[model samples]
Target: MAGIVACVLLSLVTMVHSQVQTAFLEYMQSRMGSVEERIAQWHDHSSRYSSELRDFKNQVLKMLENIEKEREAMRNEVESTNVRVDRLEREVDYLETQNPAPPCVEIDEKLTELQIKKKKNEKYEKLTDCSDTVSQVNAMKILKRFGSSAGLWTKDPIGNSERIYVFDGAANDTFFVFPRMKEFTLSTSTRKAARIKLPFPWIGTGHIVYGGYLYYVRQTEEFQVIKFNLANKTVDDSAVLPIEDQVPVYGLSKHNYIDIVADEEGLWVIYATRENEKNICLAKLDSKNLGIEQMWDTPCPIENAESAFVVCGTLYVVYNTKLPSRSRIQCIFDVSGTISSENVPVVYFPKRYGSHSSMKYNPKDRQIYAWDDGYQIIYKLSMKPKDELH
Candidate 1:
């Protein structure tokens, strides 16, 4: 019975050990399966994360490539702009070197001859005759008269009676002032006169006395206007007359005559071309620098404009008509630079004496003085009223 009990106990112990072993093995198997599933999920998650990282890197590379392309385009644009600026600078430099100073004189071809002629002939009549004449001795007395005439006269408008100014260029090449009225007498040989010497030997073509100074034009290689101070008796300044391109070069021929006159405004240089193209050019000067301020070219050429003088801004040109007897005609030109078709009647002077005559306008007396050096006489005439003349 004791041996049977020992065997039964050992079997029971064996059975318990087998059961515990089975339970432990089943628990270990379940744990292992869970660990295997976790490992597979981790691998799938890592693959997805790597694919996402690669796509992010590709996007970054594309953005970098776009930025580089934009930078290159901007650089190219800047280089093109720099090249254009350099080219523009070079062009401006070339233009400045090619032409330094341009001409100040401007041309206006719109002005017509008919317009000028109409202005000139507005006052066709009312030009008075040369009714009065004065000898050189009684030259001052002629200024007191009322009638319109042309003559030589001297009156001390400045109240300086100690000396008298004379426009006579015949007795002396230079302008002269006499101390006494008797000195101006052509017949008197004993009377003395003071002469204002010029810088060069000049043939006085035209002259005017203004602001106590004498202004005249001398013909040299070209016409030059010389200003002589009457009080100081010194040549103040001089300038060459600006001739137009159409005008012929200087010569000793008949085409070289230039007439210069001045009114209250300033000086005027009048000249005409020779031959068929008798183009007339008038230039207004700047008194300070003697530069050309304004210029006008006549619409049509004048036939024979021997001498010219300005009065009340009207230009009167003396024309010698050899035909129908030797007589002189006064052609009027308005300020518009138009010649009159209707010839104004003037106190006729012989064509021989016309060359020696100097026409001048006295603003104070409002009369025109024609100094006839050939006859040694002066003719005086009054300017007609604008209403009557026009």
Candidate 2:
């Protein structure tokens, strides 16, 4: 009986120990699953933070590149400014050397006298009737016979008191120089002559002699004012007058002619356009570079203006007349906006209207020269007050 009871007690102890082992195993499995879940969440958060950091780094790189490019652009701009300033300084020094300071004089009195002269010149009025007597008028006889189809006669631009220049456009494009004297008679010789060849073949309309150079229009695609240097006998392409954009349909036809005149104020280019509502443009040329300095536009008084000339800063437009009673109509305009519609008497020329007729005023002689190209004769009219008789 004692042996049997000991065996029963051993069995009971073995069963209780197996139950305790099973409960311990179940608790350990639940704790391990919770820890594994927390670890997985941490790993996901780390990956997201890494991606955000990479995007921020890329943005910083782009910003740095932009800043670098801007710095380079600023450096280039500063360098260009410095170069321009240096060039300007050099130009200023050269101009100073060319024009020296004049001697001191009566400043106030000289200024007052200049003001008075300016006012007097500004108050220009149409003078009395121009003389109609051809015989009584002083004539400048053409000494040299040029084969010119078109010509302009004007006073010497070099300040020679007794000389005149004749720019013959079609006569082999020659420039004839004539000398004035006490007696006037026709001759067959010239004091000096020069041949001017333009880039184009067409002859220009109006011509002006200025500072040993002859300025005329080059009837090219764009009506360009060409400067022919007599000293070098070369055409200065750099000194072309800027008028292409200033005029409408610049080189449309021969009728759109450009008239050039030079006076105390410098060179002037005058033209009337039919396209721009028949407006007239007057441009003051830069004497040194032949650039347009100042421009003025006004309504044209006459249509199909044949010729334009300026005297004492006053502009005159001449129109052709076919009627026997009327020879030519002269329209005077003051560009300073002072005078308008001043009726100046027209001088009658009997059967002298030609296609290539031109008129010029000689300030030194105070005479008006009208060229009759058809007859190859130049008729002179005196502008002097004494010569005007009713």
| TM-score of decoy 2 | 0.51
Candidate 2 lDDT at 161 equals 51
For residues 1-390, write the lDDT of model 2, one tens digit per residue.
998998998888998988989889888988889998889999999999999999999999999999999999999999999999999999999998999878887668778556533433233233422322222234544433354445666664446655556655532355556555312235444534433454444354466777777777665556666777766778764444433453421222243366777644557777654545465666666656776655555454445455655655556665554432334435555555544434355544444435434565554444555455523445455443323332
Highest TM-score among the candidates is held by which one?
Answer: 2
lDDT of each: 0.52, 0.56
Which portions of model 2 show Cα errors greater than 4 Å? 1-149, 161-164, 169-172, 178-185, 189-202, 236-256, 302-304, 322-326, 342-356, 374-390
Q: Model 2 misses residue 176 by how many Å?
A: 3.6
Q: Lowest-scoring 10 consecutive residues by lDDT in candidate 1? A: 131-140
Tell me the tens digit of each residue's lDDT in model 1 across 12-97: 99999999999999999999999999999999999999999999999999999999999999999999999999999999999989
